[model samples]
Target: MSGFPPAQIIPPQVLLGAYAQGVFPMADQGELTWFSPLMRGVIPLDEKFHVPHGLKRSLKRRPFEVKWNSNFRATMQGCADRERTWIDATILESYCLLHRLGYAHSVECHDADGLQGGLYGVALGKAFFGESMFSRKTDASKVALVALVERLREKGFLLLDTQWLTEHLQRFGGEEIPREDYQRRLKVALGKQDGTFHPPALAPGV
Candidate 1:
């Protein structure tokens, strides 16, 4: 087996720098792949995003339901199961460590019978950095995100970083600012006191 088979450990400083620069690393078939997408996706705190009418109605009805910090491992593993994934054994373990510390967090959505829908990342600071999310049901991921935005706004969070933009995110008021602007936001957020999240990472004031 090649030396690459083992998950290469990325230093915390390196990962943090990647977050500051709006970039992240992933393993592409055992090779390190770095990404910084041009159009970053993010939900504006004050904007109204259009959720599909059907989903909105569904939310009013059964409301599959959303919660924070409830099943971190399941959500992370779900995100890692995509066709091509970066959350290899080493990376997953590292992020779990981050979760244990006061760094990483997950916002989870569940169905009527308590099945996971999707989840996103949360790193406290002026900025709440969002990682990837997935959904088993139609509005699962989207509703989960809406709840996150609501929580962030309530918590007095300064920046909500989504890294890069996407069309699905556009319907939810996501927009792309220049890289320089992004870096500036990150710099301040990283420096200022933004609170912390450890295991039992809960919504603000929880």
Candidate 2:
């Protein structure tokens, strides 16, 4: 996707304000750039969300222990562990601050081998803007996604912003809509009551 001019630093307030306006930042060539795609990718929070048949079987098997906000920094690191990634030191440090402020969250999968897969995102009002996810084991990240959707639904969240659609995300009913339509939906989500990321109903390892 296209982006604005590079920025060396991104403050927490500026980052949150950008997301609230349907914009997000990424690092390109070691500089932070902002983007608001013409076609936005969003995963439906309702029944339209699909859990693949094989993943459902894996879920029943419960291959990894699911946890929320246990190790958020680790989760972000996992997402940035790719050969090529947009998550730079500035992005990492900024989001970690958001996590500490209770605005960012992670859904993690762990086994005896330690952390295997997970996802992280920013939560504002009733919307959750998914940043990235990673998997070190088969179906680990997918299972974490399932857990995330379940938690969002349970918490009364309305929008699941995926930034852009990918084939992997399409398997779970992720769709692309024109920017205008996306902004409308985003407004509704932001106008609603804020959704709690960690409700009392969830324990340490849920």
Candidate 3:
């Protein structure tokens, strides 16, 4: 990964433009920074995408009610609720604006107790950037991930960018590719006009 200091406030257009070029921002030690990794992590949107046997069983149990764009800020907070996080105030505010503009979204899992887990990310053309996810209950975040993949597939999305590969994501077919290869795929995804975060035929429930 390579990075440089960024402005305190990243405009929505700038953020979208950066995503188009395969760069993204994070907050590090209260400072904004931009990075484009040498190897990019992506989750397959096709058949290669996997749901582990255990998670498949959890899916059947319907542990939580899945919803889209419901409590987006809360979902971001969930992802940021860890001990050390990159989702600082500036990152939070910028992404919230993106959500308002319909470029950012959340996949939430809720139960009788309240919000259990979820994820938040940015959607542009046929690409969806998986920023971060958090779980408040067992498998709640995993369920939300499964639901997100299904939704993206239903809407004909072609790319699922994870930024970096992690062991947690490898089970779900997440892999890292050279930045050049990633940029090529990103271009193809951005060129397509049919993909969208929200489609009229689909409701928020999953």
lDDT of 3 by residue, 151-174 (tens): 889988889999999999999999
Clashing pairs in 2: none
User: Least lDDT summed over 10 consecutive residues: which range in candidate 1?
Assistant: 193-202
Candidates' C-alpha lDDT:
0.68, 0.85, 0.85
Question: Across residues 1-206, which tens digit of lDDT does each residue of candidate 1 receive?
Answer: 12335455665655655665668666666666677765555667775545667667877875667777677778888888788887787667666666656567777788766746676564745577787888877777878887877777776666777777788888777888877677776677666433332222346434
* Model 1, runs deviating above 4 Å: 1-5, 48-52, 193-206
lDDT of 3: 0.85
Better of 1 and 3 by lDDT: 3
Candidate 2 lDDT, tens digit per residue, 56-146?
8999999999999999999999999999999987788889888877788899999999999999998887888999999999998999999
Off by over 4 Å in 2: 1-9, 192-206
Q: Which portions of model 3 miss their true places by more than 4 Å?
A: 1-8, 192-206
Error of 2 at 38 (Å): 0.4
| Residue 139 Cα positional deviation in candidate 1, in Å, after optimal superposition | 1.0
**Cα shift from native, residue 76, model 1 (Å):** 1.2
